[model samples]
Target: MAKLTKKQKEAHAKIDKSKSYDLAAASSLVKEITNVKFDASVDIAIRLGVDPRKANQMVRGVVTLPHGTGKDVKVLALVTPDKEAEAKEAGADYVGLDEYLQKIKNGWTDVDVIITLPSVMGKLGPLGRILGPRGLMPNPKTGTVTMDVAKAVQEVKAGKIDFKVDKTGIVHAAIGKVSFDAEKIAENAKEILQTVIKLKPTTAKGTYLRSIHISSTMSPAVIVDVKTV
Candidate 1:
């Protein structure tokens, strides 16, 4: 095994691996351990007791973090010429139709979120192999495919994020940056936790939320008490 650096060892020393912390305490501890120079992202990992393979047990939803994600979210709006101005005015980083579609075809998925109208979805069908894998494909359920291009772009810019349980039954997401106040980090974590609780699949048996953990981009994971969440 690789040796831990002095900073890494110090960070680990401050954490009690045997004890689970409340949301607030976990959030604060994560900030105390983050020693990266750049603003490291504060991430939350939730393990659910549902079988992701089962159709009825699928958990997916969107949540707008109360304090907003500290990172700048880049949004791409693929719409007709008529809606180009609307998307641009709403803070979309890239806007257009054919040219952008061709760019995507050539494996140019440099944007974070992709928003397009229902009419334009047909044109994107062939490019699913490129977009689907990158999580850039616009979907109606996630509000990424809609006629309201402006509203979608604005929401994404304001910290709206969509998440789904992975095959391993773990839902991972970045809540905010370590630079944010401990209270802000806790609030963001709570917002996502509450939202996840609300999305519990009816068919899921046993404990819905099995475990929860919070950590910074380069810090040790802090286990969060399921009861306090």
Candidate 2:
């Protein structure tokens, strides 16, 4: 195999892209981190048919990352009367009732993710329906339903983003950036693929995965050879 060039070595070192500084020496670091220049998270988003730019919904679900997501995520909970403390103890950022629904209605649309309990579903289900059409509903079949309050909070805080196959039979989500270490993003990608595989609907026919394309948060999409993933 050919030896990696000095430029390549320097590029690999830029994988630790902390926002503190955009080191001039690391100009090619993002490209070097991997043989690609796309956002792994955004790439994952595209494969699932999610047009991040125009996505009007927030399809919620969960997946246990065998290799773990490389980034941190904020977690929020929507609980009823008795579940507030449980949600807090579980490390939820904010726990409340239906009142907070307005936040979603208003312009506080930074809900990167959410998870809810089953008992509260009946009450919140319809509310979630509003977000569902916008791809913001938290459905269990997509890994959104859970009775475990702590699990929901922890996964979100730990960067466990949720994505569900849309009506078109595809799921999209952000895993990480291509500027991220290939190994890191690749690991997360594997975890996501495995989860999607498990979510395969027994009722469906033909190819389980129509296709998968990887890209950056602001870049063109690239098809990955994930025949094994």
Candidate 3:
């Protein structure tokens, strides 16, 4: 092995001590340059440095999770008799019909994700306010309102990742962990970067992607080279 420089030695040492993808190296970088005291989230967030005052720069979108939610996201699909079998074939935990709308309304909190055929939203009434804040409402723009029940269930089971810009115009999502091989994690990270790159709004001026960083669930984000990305 080539002799390690002091900086490289320190960087690797931080990651080694972190056990999981705590993103220690990224935190070390912030401490080194900014001298800002921070925990993992703040440490990772500072790198975004996106001006929150400007709403247009925010990055937000949704992606089908490849590994399903780390937690079982019980999927419920609202469909007609014609579509029930397809929904079942697609792995819906519960295949509901228009009639069950009342039953679901009575027991709304029990559901995790809701998939509705194009016709079901009418029955939802004003409950969107209740579901919207929790991000449970199925909106057409996000590809939630559709008749394709099987695909919806499969995507949910595979850990569909969601990215939304925070107050600082930063988008973050959980891809996996350091326990995963470096190549796999890097690949997942790259996919996220690519998604964000494509999501850059044409209306937004200035640099669409101000910067790109990768961080594990509890780690600091390290600024990755976007040019190579």
Candidate 4:
């Protein structure tokens, strides 16, 4: 095993492995333990008791963080000429139909989020192999496929994010940056937790939220008490 650095050792010593902290305490501890040169992203990982393989137990939804995510989200609006101006006005980083589509066909998906109209989804069907795995495929359920391309682009830029449970039954997401105040981090975490709770599949049995952890890039994970959240 690799030896821990002085900073890593100090961070590890501050966390009690045997204890689970409340949401607020965990949120504060996350910032304290973060030791990185760059402004690291504050991430939350929640393990849920659900069989993701079962269609009925699939958990996926969208939530807008109370305070915007500290990172500047890159948005790609794949729309026709009629909606090009509106998409650009709404701050989409890339707005075009054919050129962007051609780029995507050539294995280029450089944007974070993709928003397109329902009418345009048919054209994207053939590119599913490239986009689906990256979670960049626009879906109506996630509000990424809609006639209001501008609204979707604006929402994404404003911190609206969609999350889905992975095959391991863990939903991981970045809540904010370490530079954000502890309260802001807590708020963003709470918002996502509440949204996840609301989306609990009726087919799921046992404890829905099995465990929760908060951490930053390269920081030790802080355990959070699910009940207190």
Candidate 5:
């Protein structure tokens, strides 16, 4: 195993492995432990009790963070000419159809989110291989594929994000940057937790939220008490 750096060791020292902290305490502690010079992204990982291998147990949904993700999201709007103005007015970084599609086909996915009209989905089917793996593929369930291009683009720009439970039954999402206040981080974390709770599958028998942890990039994970959250 690689030896921990001085900062890494100090961060780990602050966390008590045997104890689970309340949401608010964990949020505050995460900020204190992060020693990176740059504004590192704060992330939360929730381990659920569902078996993701079973179709009925799959969990996936979207939530708009109370405090917008500190990162300025870049959005690419692929729409017909008529809807181009609407998309642009809604704050889409890149707006167009054929040209953007051609660029994507040429392996250029430089944007954070992609919003497109329902009619344009068919054309995007062929590029699924490229976007799917990158988690950039627009899906109707997440409100990315729709006729109201402006609404979709605006929502994404305003901190909307989608998350899905992985095969290992863990849902990981970036909540905010370390630069945000602890209260802001707690609020964002609560928003995601509540949304996931509401999406609990009926087939999920045992404990719904198995474990929750919050941390910043390169910082030790802070265990959060699910009971308190």
Candidate 6:
């Protein structure tokens, strides 16, 4: 194993591995432990009891963070010419259809979120291989594929994010940046956590939320008590 650097060691030393912290305490501690020069993203990892393999137990949904994700979300509006103006007016960074489709075909997915009209989805189907793995495929369930281009673009720019449970039953999402106040981080974390709780599947047995952890891009994970969440 690679030896930990002094900063990494110091970050690990600040937390007690045996104890789980409340959301507020974990949020504050994560900021304190992050030593990266740039503003690191604060992420929360939640392990749920549900099995992603089961259709009924699969958990996936969207939530708008109380404080917008500190990162500026670059949105691509893949819409017809008629909706181009609306998408642009809604603050989409890239607005177009065929030209952008060709760009993606040539492996240029430079944007964060892709919003497109329902009519445009058929054209996108052929490019699923390129977009699916990158989590860029706009799906109706997540409100990414819709007729209301402006609303979709605005929501994405305003901190709306979609998350799905991985095969291992863990849901990982970036809540905010380390530069944000602890309160903002805590609130963002709460927003996602509460949303996840509400999405608990009826088929899921036992504890829905198994374990929760909060950390920054480069910091050690801080265990968050499931009870306190």
Tens-place lDDT per residue, model 5, 1-229, is 9999998999999998999999889989999999999999999999999999999999999999999889899999999999999999999999999998999999999999998888999999999999999999999999999999999988998899999999999999999999999999999999999999999999999899999999999999999999998
lDDT (tens digit, per residue) of candidate 4 on 62-133: 999989889899999999999999999999999999898999999998999999999999999999999999
Q: Candidate 2 versus the native: TM-score?
A: 0.63
TM-score of structure candidate 5: 0.98
Instruction: Write down the TM-score of every candidate.
Output: 0.99, 0.63, 0.66, 0.99, 0.98, 0.99
Model 1 over residues 1-229: C-alpha lDDT tens digits?
9899999999999999899999889999999998999999999999999999999999999999988899899898999999999999999999999999999889899999999999999999999999888888899999999999989998988889999999999999999998899999999999999999999988999999999999998789999999898
* Model 3 Cα lDDT, one tens digit per residue, 118-172: 8878877567667777767776655567877788777877766566677757775
Candidate 4, which segments miss by more than 4 Å at Cα? none
User: Between prediction 2 and prediction 3, which has the larger TM-score?
Assistant: 3
TM-score of model 3 (CA atoms)? 0.66
How far residue 97's Cα lies from its native spot in candidate 6, in Å, is 0.3
lDDT of 5 at 229: 82
| lDDT by candidate, in order shown | 0.94, 0.56, 0.60, 0.95, 0.95, 0.95
Clashing pairs in 1: none
Candidate 2, 5-67: lDDT as tens digits:
775565445544333211221222323444444334434632343332333432334666544
TM-score of the candidate numbered 4?
0.99
Higher-ranked by lDDT: 3 or 6: 6
Off by over 4 Å in 1: none
